[model samples]
Target chain A: MAATDKIFQHGTLGLLVPGLFDGTITAGELLTHGDTGIGTLDGLNGEVIIINGHAYQAREDGQVREIAADETLPFASVHFEKPDISAPIEATNQADFETQVVRDYRLRNVFAAIRIDGTFKTIKTRVAPRQQPPYKTLVQATATQPEFSGEHVQGTIVGYYAPQLFQGATVGGFHLHFLSQDHQLGGHLLGFEIEQAELKIQHFADFQVHLPIDNEAYLQEEFDNETIDHAINKAER
Target chain B: MAATDKIFQHGTLGLLVPGLFDGTITAGELLTHGDTGIGTLDGLNGEVIIINGHAYQAREDGQVREIAADETLPFASVHFEKPDISAPIEATNQADFETQVVRDYRLRNVFAAIRIDGTFKTIKTRVAPRQQPPYKTLVQATATQPEFSGEHVQGTIVGYYAPQLFQGATVGGFHLHFLSQDHQLGGHLLGFEIEQAELKIQHFADFQVHLPIDNEAYLQEEFDNETIDHAINKAER
Candidate 1:
């Protein structure tokens, strides 16, 4: 038998200590039955009292008191301490960028990711265009829902920003996008659905806006004559 | 063969889709030769096909693409959202009591069971004692240095409670206890070990704290005190 199996048998014999056996037993037999090898037995004066390396001695006091099973055992007890909760200084890091869009001096893009929570979703936003100042320019802007077709997914805008691209300039505009998921596009390839799906662009009329283009006055009036378009489309039955 | 064995054979057959065996005639013949009686011949029929009670129809133009040996399958992407932060309302039925040396009041004791992040282990907090007016009591506590030893655990006081016991005419000499688990003392018990633990109890030295005299108050207070004491003792070792 394997050493592990022999050890298990010996352990069982230890549990059944002080029990009577039917078979005749010698010192070697007893040691083998207990699964203790010959090397573990200690012989003294041929009396064969010691076995399995432990000395056997008779107690002077013969009488013993019986105890209930529910009585507590003589075991050790210890207290446990609470854990620490402060955030480590080096553990925090900057948020990762999801996506970016750039169109000449103007940029319209959306980015989305998860926080500490396990919710699956994303965020959408837009970046304003850079321009010269003192010219009263008309800017058109519109916000629309996002479109999802065949595994192509996007999100709605919770907020937006219209910062001036040029130094010392103030410009403002509107930004928006529809939010949904598409399954037909197959994978994460972009622009594939743009060619396959019927996309409608909603146009917004010119709106009054301001920006700074010169360093002398640090103020300038500009018109964003560009139309802000947003659209959402789904597959037809 | 047993039903479980038949199910296993069916599972293996399901892995061999139409495109998977298109170029392997030998392998297909070997699989078909097995008398499993749990397979369909037309894996890409235009009409709906049923196998093991599951119905699937192949699209006319949409054919299953053969997966490359080295190519990996695409997985779904997810974005998680942040949690909403809000305060919980305090419990009703608060009362006040007075004593010769110290004052006491009754406040609803709230205990919350919270699971630690990342680990499945659970740690329960002791019921907090909130005192009434004139005591200027607050239970602003935080957990720190939480350590577990055998069955007992210990934690440091990153925070403390001023006037740990409530003092007043309606609620005097009020104490709080935190229990880890409920068990009979005379039954089989587990030993606990602790490295370091401490609770900074700050009370007025001029007044002597008295245990509650009323049966209801006395029993509750006794239970709470004993639980806290036991936990502390276990943790302190």
Candidate 2:
């Protein structure tokens, strides 16, 4: 059986692996699971793009390059997507657009993997810088993140919408990452105003989590749930 | 690899499988994944008890029998557990008991698999009657369910406490089932008053959903989040 046929995830997002420098799962190995998703490179170098079975690294310097098969990542969410619905939408901001999308598509309570491709009036994004050992949590890592804003940025946003009940295991609400069509701009999506775009969602009827079962940090951490939740909210925000 | 080493589940509670009929996964196969959990029998015959790698059929007639390994069930949640913490507690009612458990253990905002064994002052439960084809939703099926109340019932309560974000994937809050020490009375747990009990919980850091991917009803159903949520709440209430 093909491994990538399911929603393959690696590491506990809640357990907080500080950086990707020691990421255990290889890009080549990960690709065996899904062809499209988002993550970061070794050392939390920048945003990661997995599309059409090719992995790309988009850096803070706006330099985009193809990641080698041997390269690894700290965390990622990917799926062998087969969209059940495709539709067009119009909206001005992130909030209104998401509300309209959900209302229009009637996707209130289901797990959905979505891809939106289009032009935007303004796109705001952020990429986490590289890190060293004695790492802090992701929220702390992103506290000093660099922001990018541009007009008429054409890109694709890829992510998922999980029911709020799955907040810890997955972000309960919409979580999206962006990559420019030219491959020069990309990061965790902060905000964007859609000019026109196509919204495609695959009914994600199943989910699975693979943890760093042998990782020392994951095993030792007490994982005070409130602290982790707050950290996740801040990072997502 | 041992299958019981991870949490294993089948079918979608969100899709509301009406009765335990034509269930494909066998008890032997399920035991290969987990040793303890709860579920219903064919045609919603009665409660199912699985513990220590053995399966028991607890029927409406208060008859308990060792389930053949080949017997199947509609829904169940179980894990190969290694509890992170175990302690004692006191509470007077279901709400108070749950509150005390969370407070005493300080379990918040995390997915937890819990087991409590001891004497209960009052144990209240309900079981769905056997259903036929053209089945209704679980909410409808339990509309006229039978309730059983017993004083000083000795049993073990088994279930999970999922964060609100996972409400669709699992019951967002505490979802539990009970099996008496005698194994003659059991079903989905509705309410209980703890006289004295030891609470054991595992930091269930992983989750996986295995749906009846080929079931026609599952494939065709469009779940309305609000309606399903309401139904679940009413049934649990």
Candidate 3:
């Protein structure tokens, strides 16, 4: 199979990049696999947004900057969005948007790669600050997460509809990350009010796994650490 | 990515072979992708077992036969298992076996492709019979599933550990299908008493989706039909 047809995941959510020191996978290398996805920089430095083949780092203080190809990521999940279906959605809140997608798009059982583009009358987001070791769980790392709320912003929501069974495997339901169309603001999506947006949907029927078994930090850590789930849901949700 | 590193899936569990008439994906074509996985024969004729590059059909009458390359499948998920970890396990029942695996093998939080070979003191299994058109949900079709129990049998348990989040996506967790060493008995695993067993494990770090969009039967079905989840759990679990 071609590299572009499958989802590329580095590191497991079971082992969140808490060992920020082990950010061995470079951003440039990740881009070769997919044109869009979401992830974090070394040290949980900030939330990441990759759209249209370029990477952006959204920091906790509500700052967004283009990341260089040399930048490395401890973990990330990305896939090229080749839409099989595209439609427009009108919703007042985040819940309304999801219901409309499920109802109108009929994307219930399959894995979906979605790109929603347009204006948001109100958008809420958060970015995790840099951390130090002994690294804490992802939830703990983001204990002091900074929230950014803005109005009249133009951005795109890049995310996937993970099947419910893969809840802890990936972000169970619709997991989305946002970036302003102008590339000025972005972070893990908390909520949004859509003024208007067009949705581009791609259905995925295959899966691939990219393990970090070779990394020293990955191998040495106890990935089955029980707290990882709580951390993952907190961070991703 | 090589074919060995990805899971090849045809059609969606939500769609099933409701239109059993649409089972156009040949076993030969599916085998070209991976060597180990499970599915049902066309028309949900029987449970399917593919291992070590060969296909076997376990029918409702307790008969097992090697399937022809040209045999078609409505849906299946398969991948070559390359063990990153292997070990021995001892347990009396299925539940005990799973707990021992999780505790000793530490296969939590990620997807696992596993093979368990050994002598079974007792084995309990079931096979879904062929369904007629104007088909019912998988659960209903499987309501009269035939049960088979055997003792002093030697076999291998072929299965995958799906993360909880992917609940409806693929059997949710630890889905195992058994094939007797004598090649005469096999079906979806229900319960078992293991005399002793050895395990070979592979961890997946990526995923790919292969949809059956070209099949006429697939195109005519409604995948979002809500009854699919109940049917899937009943038939799969």
Which candidate leads in DockQ?
3
- TM-score for all predictions? 0.11, 0.65, 0.76
Candidate 3 chain A lowest-lDDT run of ten: A219-228
CA lDDT, candidate 1, residue A220: 18
Model 1 reaches an interface RMSD of 34.3
Q: What is the per-residue lDDT of model 2 for residues B1-237, given as tens digits with 9 covering 90 to 100?
A: 544334666654665533325465678887777877766665666667677777776666556688888777767677876787888866768798788766665445455678889999989877767677777677778788777777899998887776544555567678887888987677778898888888888765456767665555554465655665677677655
**Best-to-worst ranking by TM-score:** 3, 2, 1
TM-score of chain B of each: 0.14, 0.89, 0.91
Those runs of model 1 whose alpha carbons end farther than 4 Å from true positions after fitting are A1-96, A99-113, A116-237, B1-46, B49-237
Q: What lDDT does candidate 3 reach at residue A152? A: 91
State the weakest 10-residue window (summed lDDT) of model 1 chain B. B73-82
**Candidate 1 vs candidate 2, DockQ winner:** 2
Every candidate's DockQ is 0.01, 0.22, 0.27
Q: Which prediction has more favorable DockQ, 2 or 3?
A: 3
Give the docking tier of candidate 2.
Answer: incorrect
lDDT of 3 by residue, B1-237 (tens): 345555666655666624443466899998887889888888888888889989899999999998898888877778886877777776789998888776565555456787889988999999988877777667678878999889989999888875543444566568888999998789989999988888888777544446665555554454442355566666787
Interface RMSD (Cα, Å) for model 3:
5.7
